[model samples]
Target: MPKISPKLAICIVYVAAMMMDGLDATIVGPALLAIGGALGVSPAATNMVEVSFLVSFALVIPAAGWLADRFGTRRVFLGALAVFTLASGLCGAATTAGGLVAARVLQGLAGGMLAPVGMAMLFRSFPPEERLGVSRFLMLPTTLAPALGPILGGFLTDHLSWRWVFWINLPLGLATVLFGLLALPEHVEEDAGRFDLRGFALATPGLGLLMFALGEGAARGWGDPLVLGAGLLGACLLALLIPAELRSPAPMLDLRLLADAPFRSAALVAVLASGGLLGMLYVFPLMYQDALGATALDAGLTVFPESLGLMLATAAIGWSFPRLGARRVMALGLLGAAAAFVLMSRVAPGTSPWAVRALLLAVGFFLGHAVLAVQTVVFDTIADEAMGRASSLLSVLRQIGGAAGVAASAAVLAASGGAGLGAYQAALLASVAFLGGALLFALQIRPAPAPQLRAEAEPSV
Candidate 1:
C-alpha cells in the first residue's frame, strides 16, 4: 500500500470538492417535478437549468487549464472553490426559476475547474505507482457522488425542503476551500506561453453553437432554420479549429498529443464510451421515475449502482495496471462494460428496477477502468512542458463526448417521437455499439513498461 502523504490530504480535499459539485448537479433531479408542480411549468423541459450548467462547463474547460498554467494552480483552484460555495448559497436561496438557473451557471463555471486542476496537482505530487493509487482513491468521489447525490438530495427535498439541496453544499464547500489553501502547493510559473486566441475563437463558438442547436432542436423542430444554421455553422467552425490547432504555436490545445497511438485510439474510445454512459445518466434517471412510477429517491438509487461498480473497478485497475499494462487492463474493462451493455439492451418496459440497477453497477466498473486508462495515457504521452494544455484538452474532449452522447440520444427520441422505455432502450443499444467500437480501440493500445517517475512531475508549462 502506498503511504498517505500531505499530497494525499489534498486529494481528499479534491474528493470533497468533487462531491460538492456532483451533489449540486443531481440534487435538483428529485426536485424538478416538484418545482414544475409549484411553478406550473412543464418539468420535462426543466432540464434547461441543468443543461446550462453543462454548457458553461463544456465551453470553459480548455480555458481553465490554460489559465492554471498562466496563473497559479493554487490560486485558481482556491478561488474556484470559494466561488462555487458562494454560488451554491445563491442557488439555494433562489425563489424564481431564472434566479436558480443563473446561480447554476455560476456554480458550473466554478465547478468546471475542480476535476482537471485537482488532477494537475495529484499527478505532479507523486510518482506513477503512487499516482495510480491516488487516481484509484480519487475514484471514490466519482462513484460515490452519484449515489450520495440522490440520497442527500432526496433527504433534503423530503424533509427540510428542496432548497436545502443546494444549501447543503455550503459548509462542505467552505471546508474544501480551506483544505485546498492549506494543502495544495503553489506552482507560480510566471511565463507559461502565448494564448491561442484564434484556436479559442474557433473551438468555443463551435462547441457552444453545436450544443445550442442540439438542445433547442427537440423543442423548435428539426425543420427550424435556426437549428440547421447553428448545427452547420458549428460543424464548419470546428473543422477550422482543428487545422488552426495544428498550425498554432502554444496552441490552446496541442494537436500533437493526438498523434500518439494509445492516446489517439483512447481519444476516440473515450468519446464513444463517455457519450454512451453520460447519456445514460440523463436518460435512466428520468425514465424510471417518470415512466415507471418510481419515486425520486428510487430513481436516483436505481442507476446509481454503477458508481459502486466504478469505484471497485477503478481500484482493481490501479492494482492490475502494473502487472497487466495499460492496454490489457483497458481491454478487460471494455469487455466487462460490453457485457453490461448487452444486458441493458434486453431490458423491457416492465423489467425489474433492481435488475436494472445490478446491470448498470456492473457496467460502471468496467467503464471506470476505461476512463482511468484514457486519462493515464493522455497524461503519459503528452510532452512534459504542455501538461496544463494537455489537461485542458482532455477535459474539453470528455465534455464534447458527453454532449454528443446526449444529443444522439435526443435524436433517438426524435425518430421514435416518444419518451417511453422504448426510446430509453434504443439509446442503450446505441451505447452498446459505441462500447463495441471502444473495445476494438482498447486492444490496439501497445503494451509497454510502466514509467518510473510520475507523468505529472515532468516539466509542465
Candidate 2:
C-alpha cells in the first residue's frame, strides 16, 4: 500500500476545515427562512445571523497571524476547531434569533483562524517548488462546500430541521480536530513578535464595521444613516490602519507585503474576481427558486454540476501554468468567466435546465481556473516568513470581496425590481461588469521570467 505523504495528510486536514467553513457560509442562505420561522423573527431580522458571523470572522482574521506565531500553528488550529465546534453546538441549541446570532459570533471568532493558519501550515510544509499542486488539495473543500451546502441544507431542513444545519458541523469539526491533534506537527516560530494592540484596535473594528456595513447595505437602504455612517466610519478606520501598521515595529498584519508587485496584483485580482463569483453564488440559487419556480433541493442540484467543472478546471491549472504561462492562463480564465456571466445574464425564467446548468458549469470552470491562477501567483511571490500574514490577508480580502459581491448584487436586484427575470438579468450584468474589471487586472500581470517558472515547476505529487 502506498503511504500517505505528510503534505497530503496536512492538506486533508485543511480541506476538512475549509469544507466546514464553506458549508457554514453558504448553508445559511438555504436555511434562512426556516431559521426565521423557528426563532419567530422576520426575514430581515434573521439576516443578522449571517451578518454576525461575517463581522466577527472579519474582525478576528488580522489576529490570526499573531496568535499562530505566539502560540503554535498546530495548537492554534486545534483550539480554533474546538471553539468552532462548541459554537456550532451553541448555534444549534439556540431558541432565539439573538442567541443564534451571538453563537455565530463565537463561531466566526474561531473560524477566523482556520483558513489562514491552515494555509500557512500547508505553505510551510510544501516547498515553493511543489506549491502548484496545492491547488488540487484546496479544490476539494473549496469546490465541495458551496456545492454541497445548499443541497445538504435543503435536505436537512426538508427532512429534519434547520437547526440540524448547525448541528451537522459538530461531528465533522470534532473529528477533524481529533485527527489534526495526531497528524499535525508543531512549527512554532522562535521570535514571534509582540502582538500589536494598537494595530489590532484599529484593524479589528475597521474590518468588522466595513463588513457589517456591506451586510447592512444588502438589506437596508444604502442611504440609511446607519449604513452610511458605518461605511464612512469603517473607511476612515481602515485608512488609518494602513499608516499605523506600516509605521508599527510589531504590526498585527504585515502591510509591507503589499509592496511586492506580484502579490499586490494577485491580491487585487482576487478581490475583483471573487466579487463576480460570489454574486453568482448568491444570485443563481435565488433565480432558480424564485424565477424558475424550482424547489430548494432541485435548485441546489441544478447548481451542483458547477463543482465538477470547478474541480476539473483547478486540476488543469497544474498542467497548463507551466506551458501557457500564468498571465495568459489567467487572462483566458477571466475572459471565459466574463463570457459565462454574459450568458448567465441572458438566462430567463423559462430557460431550459440543461442550458442553465451549462452556463453555471462554464462559470465554475472559468472562475476556478482564474482564482487558482491568482492564488499561485500570490504564493509564488510571498516570502516564507510572511506566509501567515499573507494567508490571513488573502482570507480577509476574500471575505470582504464576497460580502461586497452579495451586497452589490442584492442592491441591483432590489433596485431593478425584485424576484423576476429582469432583476436576475440586471444582477447578472453587474457580475459581468465585475469580471470585466478583473479581466483588466489579469491583463496587467507581466510574464514571469523563464527562470522563475522552471524553478517553481516540480512534478505534482
Highest-scoring model, lDDT? 2
Q: Global lDDT for candidate 1?
A: 0.70
Judge candidate 1 at residue 74 and give its lDDT. Answer: 81
Total backbone collisions for each predicted model: 0, 0
Error of 2 at 285 (Å): 0.6
lDDT values of the candidates? 0.70, 0.76
Cα lDDT tens digits, model 2, 56-129, are 78768888877888899999998998999999999999998768978998999998789778878988998887
Supply the global lDDT for candidate 2: 0.76
Backbone clashes in model 1, listed as residue pairs: none
Model 2 quality (TM-score) = 0.82
lDDT of candidate 1 over 1-461, digit per residue (tens): 33446676777777888778766656676665555455444433444456657766766677776677788888888888899899989987877776876787788888888777777777777887787667656765654665677666656666677778788888998877877666667775677667778987987778777876775565566779999999899989999988899988777778877877766787777777877776666655666655567776776676667767776765576576677777776788778887887687676668987898898788878788777776666566667876666666666776667766666665565455446767666766666666777778878877779733223321100
Tell me each candidate's TM-score. 0.80, 0.82
Runs with alpha carbons beyond 4 Å of true place in candidate 1: 1-16, 25-51, 69-75, 89-103, 118-143, 157-163, 174-188, 318-332, 345-350, 376-381, 386-388, 447-461
Candidate 2 Cα outliers beyond 4 Å, as residue runs: 1-18, 32-55, 72-75, 93-100, 118-147, 175-190, 379-388, 449-461
